[model samples]
Target chain A: MSATDELVANNARYSEGFEGPLPLPPAKKVAVVACMDARLNVYGALGLQEGEAHVIRNAGGVVSEDVIRSLTISQRLLGTEEIVLIHHTDCGMLTFTDDEFKLSIQQDTGVKPTWAAEAFADPQEDVRQSIARIRNSPFVPKKDSVRGFVFDVATGRIDEVV
Target chain B: MSATDELVANNARYSEGFEGPLPLPPAKKVAVVACMDARLNVYGALGLQEGEAHVIRNAGGVVSEDVIRSLTISQRLLGTEEIVLIHHTDCGMLTFTDDEFKLSIQQDTGVKPTWAAEAFADPQEDVRQSIARIRNSPFVPKKDSVRGFVFDVATGRIDEVV
Candidate 1:
């Protein structure tokens, strides 16, 4: 079987009899914003169950305007009362300089890099700034809680940032 | 050894000499925004390497305002030109109603649920709405491309959402 096929088989075996949605315990819904690096498993790290929390991820886990808009809706329309911002060490976002990324794209696709240079630098600072921005954003519930943490890719340990 | 320790050891054994970052093909400096559901592995599914793309994840894979702001920075500063939104089947976001979540929090922490009902609801709609919102948001790069896909938790096949 191909790798994809093997993956599918594994999912079937592990998720068998998982009929539809699982029961959710009565709790205040929590939302986590984290990076999508494959190495980090938020569920395992946070010890969360299927119905425990909402997670949103984007590159660098930097809170963007779209993230804030969604957060607004999630707070105003959904049920999330708490927010967790999780960034990680050894992240891919930290590896590339903007110029190097652009050159790679140009060489691969023959498309000159049209993107600017400010987007991919210093991911840790970006996450810290995002946490501050989100905490101060008017869209977030003024009274709701927000916390930030960094997950160590090598250690599998999470360190609270603020 | 504890389960976590054993798992970490296995990861180290499997990943030894696999360090120094994954290579990025030029045209694929794409950013993936996905959900944090354990059933989905974005990198394995997409056949991506470490530096090829930045993976951002959270609940429902919904694009929030914060995500948009981050995307803007990524495109303008980091050289990323595309966005992939990946939502998966059997997501935990879909399993709970607002009341149950609130009550669970109350029971666990002995604290009253301060948030109202509007904070959390259907995750599918949340994902769909997030896609539309991101596509139309002014914060995203004008030339940047965005697409949405639904990942089958059972099959590992990602189907583009039309």
Candidate 2:
């Protein structure tokens, strides 16, 4: 069966016990931007539930224009006031650089895309950069409430990157 | 205490019993891109475990350049072979037009963002568009393995968008 087919079957079981109809806004009024790594369960790790917070995931959890876009809307429209950025240890983002990756992808597919890899050497430093990016942006409300952390993939421990 | 203070406190309890050391690559070899809606639990809804799949999320799960960048790395560097694009009903993306929203943000913050909201009139159509974007991108490998879905926020049912 297709992988999605398996997900569909999984969802059948999930919806059989689903309890939703949650409000439009997050109950805790926070938005979390984290990595897309499979091992890091953002909700379980951060103690979030279905109606608690908006969890935004991407390659490295780095702050990009799209992230800012989501944050702007999340704060302005949805009443989310706090922002948390979480990058994890042993991230695929730490594996390569933009130049080398772009070169490699070009070699692999004969296309030099205009996208930025947003790769970083240290996850903590990347978290710091992401926090600074959000805090510095005028669009994001409640900038002082922004926090950054590095979640250890090995231990599931989240350490503040201060 | 602050909102994040609560998360930090909650996480302390979570880490005490945390179990991990999962591998860097996803066991299921698939990446699921979905919305940043707080009501949706990407992991639990799809029955994905800690080491199962990559979950990339943004405002609308729209296929942007950065998403392609991540998917390229996910497929080439990591072993992710299938891609799933999930958009949800009653999404914030269905709330406004890019033109009006950009004007509103510019008025609110005195800065004009170059980013597009990628908003859509319908969730299913947006999912289809996202799947097509991933399939059309030169960077993404295994395009034929892509699928799309519209997850119902109220009932927690995920219907295939085909």
lDDT of each: 0.57, 0.86
DockQ of each: 0.13, 0.79
Instruction: Report per-prediction Cα RMSD to one decimal.
Output: 8.9, 1.2
What's the CA error at residue B141 for candidate 2, in Å?
A: 1.1
Write one digit per residue (lDDT tens) for candidate 1, span A55-90. Answer: 666656667654664465456445567777778776
Model 2 bad stretches (over 4 Å)? none
Query: Each candidate's interface RMSD, rounded to one decimal?
Result: 8.2, 1.1
Could you give candidate 2's per-residue lDDT for residues B1-119 as a string of tens digits?
Answer: 97789998888898889787888999999999888999889888998888889998888888887788778878888899998888888888888898998888899878888888787
> Once model 2 is optimally superposed onto the true structure by TM-score, how far is the C-alpha of residue B156 displaced, in angstroms?
0.8
Cand. 1: chain B TM-score: 0.77
How high is each candidate's TM-score? 0.54, 0.97
Candidate 1 residue runs with Cα over 4 Å from true position: A23-28, A103-124, B1-55, B58-162
What's the C-alpha lDDT at position B112 in model 2?
Answer: 80
